[model samples]
Target: MASSASSLTGGISAAEWDARVNLAAAYRLTALFGWDDLVFTHISARVPGPEHHFLINPYGMMFDEITASSLVKIDRDGRKVDDSPYDVNPAGFTIHSAIHAAREDAHCVMHTHSVNGVAVSAQEAGLLPLSQQSLGVLASLGQHDYEGIALNADEKPRLVRDLGHHTYLMLRNHGLLTVGATPADAFVAMYFFEAACMIQVRAQSGGGTLRPIPQPILDGIKQQIGQVTRGVTPGALVWPGLLRRLDRRNPGYAD
Candidate 1:
């Protein structure tokens, strides 16, 4: 982890600093929950300054190894703007930058390729609303077919078009992606999404009839998430606890 530099002290605002911390915490927690794919998938937050920059994990670091200071700041073009020892992954940022640039409502975007997520993505049926956990995602999910590799700049427009107005998106035959008004919202969305995939995979393995939640009940589930969560927004409420968990397991994230 890089030591905090006094020269860069006043560059990022308080709000941006908080966003960086929460995004870094989410990366560590994703690793803790066994959702990371070594160092492949990424979670990013928009930097809070005038440049409309964003923060992403350094290319070579494991998700659990990401720290707030270690996170690389980059322009929408995926060029590193900060003087860090690490390099940003341009290919990784291609998908992330598209969403952040198009959606002002999205402050944080998370992408993962956990076994269950990719397993379900590979399935012809995709996510089945067979469990209560699945309803959370079904309420506002979208699908995007896989294009060979996301590194192509030409693919950005299509990717953004497919993700229009949806919180959860299954990248068919690829993995799962979620966008949030805040980092916590995005994380919670992915949590339910990954859980749904796990349940579906397990249920399929049993070769038993799958009882799915009715479409009528989905509204109620969404309402409950909004109500019980105190309208605090999913990301804001859970982010602090995630940070504390990281602090206990690997305190270097804040370094």
Candidate 2:
């Protein structure tokens, strides 16, 4: 593992190596949580530098199988910037690139085609405020209409427009997206985003009237979250424990 880690980090800056480790952990954690859709979805992190290069999972590899060394580095155009042995799914990079190019704060962009996320995205009401988890996301959420398979570059402007300054994005009839200053931020944000969807789906299935959180309470969620997190990103507080969990469950992402 040490030898492999050295090989992957050989020429990259320490910042890039750190980004690679975090991004790889995000991928494995996605799979651990059953949020991965084969290799169809993507989680991308901007390479920390002046250039607009990014790291994304290698194409055709299961999310649980991705490691720091295997993630492919690519430019904003989805062109490979590093000579990685693995290929990337440019179509998967479409949403990620659009967000990254538009929002500097979006250091990591995570998209998931998880069952519950897609189910909620397909709903007409779209993420009803039936759960506490929904409140945090509703405070800063955006919705984008699906434009086929996301293979066309023409859809970029519209995607960026819909995602303007928001942390969570629901792709109508598709899935969910979340962006953050780091992979930890994005991963934890998606956790709440997907949790809300899961609760919504189950509640609807119970065939009972859903009690929505009151608007007055929902309006104050941002402040409430700030207090809860004490002005720190939620990920900053949560990531270390998450890494410990990952180490016990699915080790080797760093390699």
Candidate 3:
């Protein structure tokens, strides 16, 4: 395959094809939530192998226009490993590649600069424990201070250091990033993360005394989640419904 629309498989596994569909769906879903920063931020999914290859959007395409077959496969250095007509934004790949290199479980990494996400990032407190949505984010969140544009390779260690074992990373003065073993998991985490940021920004603008949730409640959020959803995987339950919704509205992502 020469990396046209038919490259959705391109000698990849059935699992890889499914990953492509989900990753493409995620791109469209980002558009659905209006979280995309045009062609700036990205969502990358690692191909299931020891080779460190990953799949990212074909640059120059809007998130909503991304398709399963059109994603470009690239290496850790952000160089294209498979043929594609699109040229990737190397600077954008820096952050994604850094996280993918650091976290083995982070098969899927999503970054966004949505209004609330960037607004929350600029806050000194960095995602306060106010709303229940924030509690979900607070459960396993890490924050990294802004380091200007992500064009430097030296930022990788610091970013990995700041991220540590946390599932979510809040880039101070930048935006939100989430990691998941699957695209759906990352998508679900980001949904909660963005919602939390949106709620915090709205609450702060209300011009009233703000109340942070008690620390004890924050600590028990994970346990509470298991109870609330009966321990079902967070994304697994909701992802199908999301795809159905997308199918009804904009159905080309799976192509």
Candidate 4:
């Protein structure tokens, strides 16, 4: 195991090592939030290469136990690019690869089946801006109809079409996906996306009138996020705290 730890960064670029650590952390963080669907859903970080390589969770490992060395590197065609003990989740990564290939800037993509996110996705109306959380998501959101478990490679183009240039994607009757320039950015988006969905679910349980945020307010949310985050990326601002929390509990992911 120590040999594996030392080899985690072996033969990888400095940037790729950083991506692995952050990606592994995102997987653990997802588990910490109860968003991991037992290794079913995926979060992929694009490796720095012209072939559009990505690092994904080794199939069968629970998210909490995922470590940097265990992540599997694969090309966009779902073929492994490295020698690792685990196999790649080709079917699962199809969703991620489609997004990574279509969007050059989306270096990381996260998908989740958290109860609230899937519950809200089932609604016909989808996410409603009943709270500020919802409003923030509503400001930059897209939706895609489910296509039977993401097994069909034929569905890739349509999925990419639905996700065109959007950061947050609500997979109707499926789950939620968020794209980002980095793993931290993707995790932050998923955190807020899940929070907004959870809030919507809880608020709907009351069966009372739902008040939507004003349209004017919705239009200004990008600026609002900028202001609230002080012109710095919200992910960078909040990621250190998340890492600290992880260090207190499960620090092995960084290896």
Candidate 5:
């Protein structure tokens, strides 16, 4: 088995190291916010190397428990090239790889099966624009039908097509996924997406007629979010605070 420190530091540039730390921080925050589904879901970031390789959590580790050193590096074919005792989740990679291979802009990808996310996904109407939070996510969201288990290589093409040019994706009967130019961007997108789902579910449970946001107002809000949030990039102002919180709770993810 590869030593944790060597596997994480070896062959990784400073930029890659930064990415790994940020992605690891995202996993910790996601778990903190109750978005993790134990060891079931994943998030991945492209390593800043010639091979276009990526890093993902070791299969058995819960998101909260994933350290930067515990993340596994793998090629596009999902073969582990790093020395680690843990195995990679092939199904997790299938969804992430589809986007990374197809969209050069996607440097990081995150997926979750949180209760609210899956609940909204199973709804026939899917993510109604009932709240401001939902509108923020809906403006940039795309939907893809769930194809049962994502183990088949053949599903990559369709998955890529469905996620075309969108940052957030609602997997029908499955969960939520988001892509970003950086790990922070992906995490922010998922944060908003998950919030939207949670709000929708809670509102629906109140047993009242839903009031959808006006289309013109919704469009305006979308523009405002883009302008104010600066293209919805996650590294904006919120990420640093999140990282600090992680450090306080769990310290460095690198082992």
Candidate 6:
């Protein structure tokens, strides 16, 4: 299987092939966790080395169906740089391209429209610090107000500006977005982001007075996160387990 997977890459660099496998896993895990919104939202990864190339899902393929070999390679303009049967998504292009161009550290960008995520995004208060999961997100979160369908090239500036160094972005009345140095980092960040929204929605449905985590505690989340993960990104610590879980439940993302 490993040899077969490598054969599908057409002799790309080992680093690029690794990126493709991780990106494919991220997509499968997103669907595994029920974060996929049909085939609408996207998750993209920067291909290793210079040259401003990226790998995004083939348009119309469900997240679970994505494989490393199936992800399409494209340039910054969302045009295919290699031979592939699949096309990229335009809205995905507008959003992912801007971040990939703007942020050097954003190696992976993930966006999803999960039910709980969209519900919390619709709230004026946005993601409140109501749980431990929320603390991780709140520590580096930003909110971007909805501006139609994100199809316009004009929305890119404001979207990037709103994201502005934050790891988590709540697209108002839209969805959730997260960026990281790798697919693992981005996927883990989105896990917390989505979990935070899910907890908030469930808590709100109870119709009781909400309790926000104290401001000082929220202020220390970065330090706490560092301690909890023992000086590594949470993704690094957990991604292996995530892949193991995927292997047990929905394997073949590496194909």
Per-candidate Cα lDDT values, in order, are: 0.85, 0.92, 0.89, 0.89, 0.86, 0.92
Clashing pairs in 5: 68-253
The residue pairs in collision within model 6 are none
Q: Which candidate ranks first by TM-score, i.e. highest?
A: 2
Error of 3 at 140 (Å): 0.8
Please provide, for model 6 over 1-255, each residue's C-alpha lDDT reduced to its tens digit, 9 standing for 90 to 100.
113465766788889999999999999999999999999999999999889999999998899999998898899999998777777889888999999899999999999999999999999999999999999898888889999887999999998999999999999999999999999999999999999999999999999999999999999889988988999999999999999999999989888
TM-score of each: 0.94, 0.97, 0.96, 0.96, 0.95, 0.97
Quote the lDDT for 113 in model 2: 93
Off by over 4 Å in 2: 1-3
Q: Tens digit of lDDT per residue, candidate 1, span 20-84?
A: 77788889889999999898889999887678899899899998877677788888888888788
Predicted structure 5, TM vs. truth: 0.95
Pitting candidate 2 against candidate 6, the one with the higher TM-score is: 2
User: What does candidate 5's lDDT look like per residue over 46-109, in tens digits?
Assistant: 9986898999988998888777777888999899986789999889999998899999999999
Name the runs in model 4 displaced over 4 angstroms: 1-3
Winner by TM-score between candidate 5 and candidate 3: 3
Off by over 4 Å in 3: 1-7
> TM-score of model 6 relative to the true fold?
0.97
RMSD of each: 1.7, 1.6, 1.5, 1.4, 1.7, 2.0
- Global fold similarity of model 2 (TM-score): 0.97
Where in model 1 is the C-alpha error above 4 Å? 1-11
How many clashing pairs in candidate 5? 1
Error of 2 at 76 (Å): 1.3
Question: What does candidate 2's lDDT look like per residue over 1-255, in tens digits?
Answer: 112677767788999999999999999999999999999999999999999999998898899998988888899899998786678887888878888999999999999999999999999999988988999999999999988999999999999998888899999999999999999999999999999999999999999988999999999999999999999999999999999999999999998
Rank by TM-score, highest first. Answer: 2, 6, 4, 3, 5, 1
lDDT of 6 at 156: 91
